[model samples]
Target: MFEKDQDKEEWTLSATLESPASVIASGFGLDTAVGEELIVVKAIRGEIYAYETDLSTGAWLLSAEVSVVDSSYVSSRPWNQARDIPSLFQRVFLIRLED
Candidate 1:
């Protein structure tokens, strides 16, 4: 998580997840297994985002907006299927405006 420092005109790190395993276990109600692959899903102010990471190197792979309904997380649609939709950042900005 991050917060913008208006005076500095930059984003600052706010908080972080100490244990991704615990978070995934609680939030998604799934127990991780050895050598299992997983994607982390985070909800910030009711908006859902997913982060894919390389388990071996801890490198970030991708981040995308996701939809959650009835405890299910829907992955982003393929580009070909979502050509008409606004980009993720644009949609997030629009949501902030609505708020």
Candidate 2:
């Protein structure tokens, strides 16, 4: 949806995560609502990827590049006894689903 006087667009969640770390999502919704879309995707480690939506097949049919930003170094040592501290992340992308 778009406002008549504003040049902005909107996204509404057409799907939801099926398991742990459930996050409400929409392609267009309020900023706070859309911001929650990443909770489920950020639960895992390793490479993550995205694809362009393929309208012909009704899918996100193209595999985009995957990027890994590991913070294992931060969790490498024990919290109390470790010599070095580990890095952390605010988000992680794990699953991809089409609605």
Candidate 3:
């Protein structure tokens, strides 16, 4: 992406070693609930999956299958309007379960 008034930045898209799976992912939610490093992907199949970084291969691996019924990401955050968090909570910690 570029702006009309700004200088153009040239870029190229290339295939990388670290890439997502073939399935169509509807949305993404970061699982910082317990200070664990995980990337969560909500697939089109109505299933949630958590992925972890494979240090040796520089790629992501499936860590766990998050149950949508019990997982707070979809059930709590997406619909709940009063879940706004402060910057301090975000900086020092992540996803305070209480507030």
Candidate 4:
């Protein structure tokens, strides 16, 4: 999750995920930090990615376990003007393989 440093507000990135896979976040040109781990989300074409921060090179390289959820509740709200309303909303669980 990325937030504005000045006001501490949550920020959301708009992305599209056609396949279920790990992505690198770098194109957004923002740094992602969860505790001591820092990363970058890169946008390639219409997709967003998450990349591991390279301490030696000062760059964000590809890493693992970053999932992009399309049509998620976090991404959807009030309603989406582009798509029809969902009939069945199911629960979602995000699990890390090698925590």
Which candidate ranks first by TM-score, i.e. highest? 1
* Comparison by TM-score, 1 against 2, better one: 1
Q: Give the CA lDDT, 0 to 100, for residue 41 in model 4.
A: 32
Q: Rank the candidates by TM-score, best first.
A: 1, 3, 4, 2
lDDT of 3 by residue, 1-99 (tens): 211223432221112222232111111222232223433323223333334433343333334445343234533543222232221121111111111
> Per-residue lDDT for 8-92 in model 4, tens only?
3223343322222433222222222222232333332333333443445432223555644343432242211213213112111
What number of clashing residue pairs does each candidate have, in the order they appear? 0, 12, 0, 13
Candidate 4 lDDT score at position 79: 16
Error of 3 at 51 (Å): 1.1
Quantify how close model 3 is to the true structure by its C-alpha RMSD in Å.
14.4
Residue pairs with backbone overlap in model 3: none
TM-score of every prediction relative to native: 0.27, 0.23, 0.26, 0.24
Candidate 2 runs further than 4 Å off: 1-62, 72-93
Cα deviation of 36, candidate 2, in Å? 11
Residue 47 in model 3: shift from native, Å? Answer: 1.1
lDDT for each candidate structure:
0.30, 0.27, 0.28, 0.29
lDDT of 2 by residue, 21-89 (tens): 344342211111112222222212332222222334433322333333333532232211112212112
Q: Which stretches of candidate 3 lie over 4 Å from their true place?
A: 1-36, 59-70, 73-99
In candidate 3 the C-alpha lDDT for residue 12 amounts to 16
Model 2 TM-score, all chains together: 0.23
Worst 10 residues of 1 by lDDT: 90-99
Q: Give the alpha carbon lDDT tens digit for every residue of 26-89 in model 1.
A: 2122222111233443334435344444545543422353434322232332211122222222
